[model samples]
Target: MTNTPTHNRERSCIACGAKASKADLLRIVRTAEGISFDASGKLAGRGAYVCSPECFDKARTGRLSHALKTKVSNEEAQVVAQALQAHIQRA
Candidate 1:
């Protein structure tokens, strides 16, 4: 995967419906395998981008599933939510 620069990558915010460069957002991808962060930003799979950890809750609620065209269970969403929460707390 390519850790491509976020420049020029127009990613829409899942919560607010705002558009911005991918560099300004975090991406979560739902591939054939499972769910994971698109850290490299060049993974080949279905993707949904959010503005930040704050938006994670909303994304996991239904926005993410809607965007990815899949089901995101509450438990699965909580995992990501807590993980992100911890990361944000660390920051």
Candidate 2:
């Protein structure tokens, strides 16, 4: 018998419009506190995905706020960007 591996779930980056595996992307969640990175991908709130720091920067302009249906302040955007960058470096 032959065995095959199933493909991981796919999601589109809000910034670049590139498609990638959900696990390969970073998830940003909108909650009562505000917009933040959801590393577990299981946060209970609206979520958006981005493929890289560049895409994250693009999203910060407006796409991210639109996706979350809430205004994202510059500080919030900066925090998320920094968090993603740190995450990328760690990985």
Candidate 3:
């Protein structure tokens, strides 16, 4: 007997390797310059998904700076955060 919802299926966090769900995580895209939030989830670029705001913060905290190949400025981080928050809210 199974009761778990399909929306809660597991997904990996690209930064910390955490398993979460499509509804519980946010996706970031690797642009030509760096990684940025892919709000549409259809952006044309490499992507890394994360489970929550904290992981996003950790990624912004130098761990993913090199992979992103660019600095994650506080202002830009705020943008990603805002977009993620909005997405979560709408869902």
Candidate 4:
């Protein structure tokens, strides 16, 4: 019998720099369309991770823009934050 090793993808939080499983952290994606929360974790774009809402807030200040390699406007950040808040409430 052949044995195979399972792989778990890990990502770092853009805000606090914490390492965690990709699924455990929230993903924010920036594409041509714009930036938004990627709940599916399979969005086709530059993605950054945040481990918690507090971290997410910190990310909006500047870290997210650096990670995405694009300028994140206040409006876009607000929209994404709203989506994250809704998703958290849902969960």
Measured by lDDT, the strongest candidate is: 2
Q: How would the candidate models be sorted by TM-score, starting from the highest?
A: 4, 2, 1, 3
- lDDT agreement with native, every candidate: 0.77, 0.92, 0.73, 0.91
| lDDT: the better of candidates 1 and 2 | 2
Candidate 2 residue-wise lDDT, 11-83, digit = tens: 8999988987789899999988998999889999999999999999988979999999999999999999999
Tens digit per residue, CA lDDT, model 4, 1-91: 8443357687899988898889999999998999999999999999999988778899897999999999999999999999899988898
**Stretches of candidate 2 above 4 Å error?**
1-8
Candidate 1: C-alpha RMSD after superposition: 5.8
In candidate 4, list every pair of residues with a backbone clash: none
TM-score of each: 0.75, 0.88, 0.66, 0.90
Arranged by lDDT with the best first, the candidates are: 2, 4, 1, 3
- The true-versus-predicted C-alpha distance at residue 90 of model 3, in Å, is 1.3
Error of 2 at 11 (Å): 0.7
Q: How many backbone clashes does candidate 1 have?
A: 0
Top TM-score model: 4
